[model samples]
Target: MWSVPVLPFKQLISSALFCALSGLAQAGSDLRADDSRLKSLETTDAGRDWEAVGRLDRLGEGFCTGALIAPDLVLTAAHCLYDRDTLEQIDATSIEFLAGWRNGRASAYRSVKRAVLHPSYVYDGTLSATRVRNDIALLQLQRPIRNTTVTPFETDVRPRKGARVGVVSYAQDRSEAPSLQEVCTVMARQDGVLVMSCDVDFGSSGAPVFSFEGERPRIVSVVSAKARVEGNPVSLGASLADELALLEAQLTGTHVGSQLPHGVSRVQVGEPRRRDMGAKFISN
Candidate 1:
């Protein structure tokens, strides 16, 4: 088990918008015994099938995980576009998507042309259900990746509690290539957030959480934050169905604020108190 400090219930309550507090209290034991270990996709053959899942590199800064949803559209976490120190939005041109990067090589490389964040998303540096729910963003690539091996993934509705899911992510320790956690349990789904028994860490933000219920896996959520529930580590993600549609609409100029320059509009919600709920944004 991951060694993480326990978060006080009061602090968790303060941070949560509509989380199932009762379910979270008992989440530690909800993980299934069959959950698979993280397997490194380091070799070309091993990572070939996941070419669409790539590293979103912020020029001089660090990187976050992202996945291609269309020929030119990349989905990722909204916070990945903000400077952690200054909390300022980063330039789209400075961002690059390194697809299927492994062992000093990549299958395809593309620069970001434009980016859009959920209008309601705020970068106040707090861990809240509100933030997690609105954490998704879409990046328009300067050039579409048309490689045969780099097919984009499709999005799907969120999974139910106890449903088996998987995650493909790059983290601080596993930065060169992505790792696949083929099996994890959705411990709880409250309001619009999913509390899952998936392992994630810095640089895993925006990593795609996939559901394999159908013939092919489809994206169900994006890694938002890593937290401890009942002294056990868990990853948090937003239910994608509605939020992803909103993001797509924003990208297609259908949403009200879609015409904004840089395609980003910021709304200020009352900032929640900054408390360490044993929660950390999974972005490097």
Candidate 2:
């Protein structure tokens, strides 16, 4: 019973299709990201079990695609910590996460030290569907990678309409490394947004979206933005069951910024879009 679709980031990117040429394997049948289903963890046994999937850099503003549900959190995409056009909110030690990056070396970098966003994520630029079902975010890592090859990710349940989901991004012509389409699907489940087909771009905003049923690979949504819908090219998420337990109790409470209880507003929906706007909003 979830079919809410407000949709309008200037009419869904004024006629969508922009994730550096997103086709998402043509949405429903060949879950494609070609090259054998989008694999490219940049070798070394293909990123050795995805070393907690990372790359969230922000220092100069430009990057997204995170994952690592613990050992210093991480999870991403609350508009990638804002600042689209002075909506501002960027200072968490300038953010950074790297972890297993590849070729540009990273296996663990850490920096940001505290962050949270899911109190009904009110970024009000009107890209409704409650802003991609409250595009999530979490950070918090100045240290604590406890490496063993980075393992950390676990948050299932939220895959339904056509299930079979998977994605691991870091896009914009494959920035450095991180790509694992692994057969996408989940083609619709509105109101908590999740119209995926996987394969995202623009640094694949907070990428994660996994859901491999039993034995590992859990996550359940994160990407957030890259819609086209009726014309295909989906991808837009935000459904960690109940906003990841209220963002893990506001990331272990103590009333975060503005005294918590739902207080962290940011708005920057379709800023100067049309640079091939396919409903892109992965922030930064």
lDDT of 2 by residue, 1-284 (tens): 21111223335442232342243324454443331378888987987877898888777557788888878887877887876557677786787899879878988898988888987676554455566677887787888798888888777667766778778887767778888987677655645566666767677887888877768787877887775544656667876665666676677664322243464221111111112222333421
**Quick one: best TM-score, which candidate?**
1
TM-score of each: 0.82, 0.32
Where in model 1 is the C-alpha error above 4 Å? 1-25, 255-284
* Candidate 2 wrongly placed segments (more than 4 Å): 1-36, 44-96, 102-108, 121-132, 138-177, 182-192, 199-236, 239-284
Q: Report the C-alpha displacement of residue 23, candidate 1, in angstroms.
A: 5.6
lDDT for each residue of candidate 1 in 34-122, tens digit (9 for 90 to 100): 78999999988888779999998887478889999887888898888887668789898898999988877888999999999988898
Alpha-carbon shift of residue 97 in model 1 (angstroms): 0.1
In order, candidate lDDTs are: 0.76, 0.68
Question: What residue pairs clash in candidate 1, if any at all?
Answer: none
RMSD of 1: 7.9
